[model samples]
Target: MGAVTSSMAAKFAFFPPTPPSYTLEEDEETGKLAMSGVPRRENVDVVRIKTKRATDVVAVYIKNPSASLSVLYSHGNAADLAQLYELFSQLSIHLGVNVMGEAPMLPYIVVRQVK
Candidate 1:
């Protein structure tokens, strides 16, 4: 397989679960945003959740995926949550999954990796 190519301005890049969709960019300095001209429209149900595992804390944006939920996580100390948000969204699209996220909100979902 070949390496993936992305065109986003965020620290990280994420694609939707579906093929030929939009990208999400997370700017450690400037929150997050969905890249324009994606194949699918932005769904209101998409959610972003901040989580911490063991001594590592990160953020994951969960999209509208039915089979397996796609997750976009940032490097532990690479950048702040702001930068990760956008990239997380884009990552999901790249992986062919919907996205769910929260921008500075409560009622978050915490997930633990069991492996």
Candidate 2:
């Protein structure tokens, strides 16, 4: 019964955006990753980290010059890193701290991990 309930829950739980909100592009000269349609910042970096689960997670790192601490922010399910880029930047500026925003993988990735 528990297994059946878990299966049903998994089937209905994830709803990643169909076309994806943004795409990652590598800068030819700098060899850095950036999100499409977002302004590139000198202090911000887009990175992909490989997890032990064999999945790659994309994260945005914002640097504040005077900041001594950092915040790891996980955005809501409804949004992706591109959608929250400005917010993360502003938060780092106002709070005077570095910010790292982690992006959620697509639904298919999550489903595959479950299996």
Report how far off residue 84 is in candidate 2 (Å): 0.6
TM-score of each: 0.30, 0.73
TM-score of 2: 0.73
**Alpha-carbon runs more than 4 Å astray in model 2:** 1-14, 75-78, 107-115
lDDT values, one for every candidate = 0.39, 0.77
lDDT of 1 by residue, 9-115 (tens): 23254321222222344444445433324333444232344456323233334465552755534343233344445565566667767544333322231322221
* Number of the predicted model whose TM-score against the real structure is largest: 2
Candidate 2 residue-wise lDDT, 37-98, digit = tens: 68989999988777898777778999999999999997535457877899999999999999
- Give the best candidate by lDDT: 2
* C-alpha RMSD between model 2 and the true structure: 7.5
lDDT score of model 1?
A: 0.39
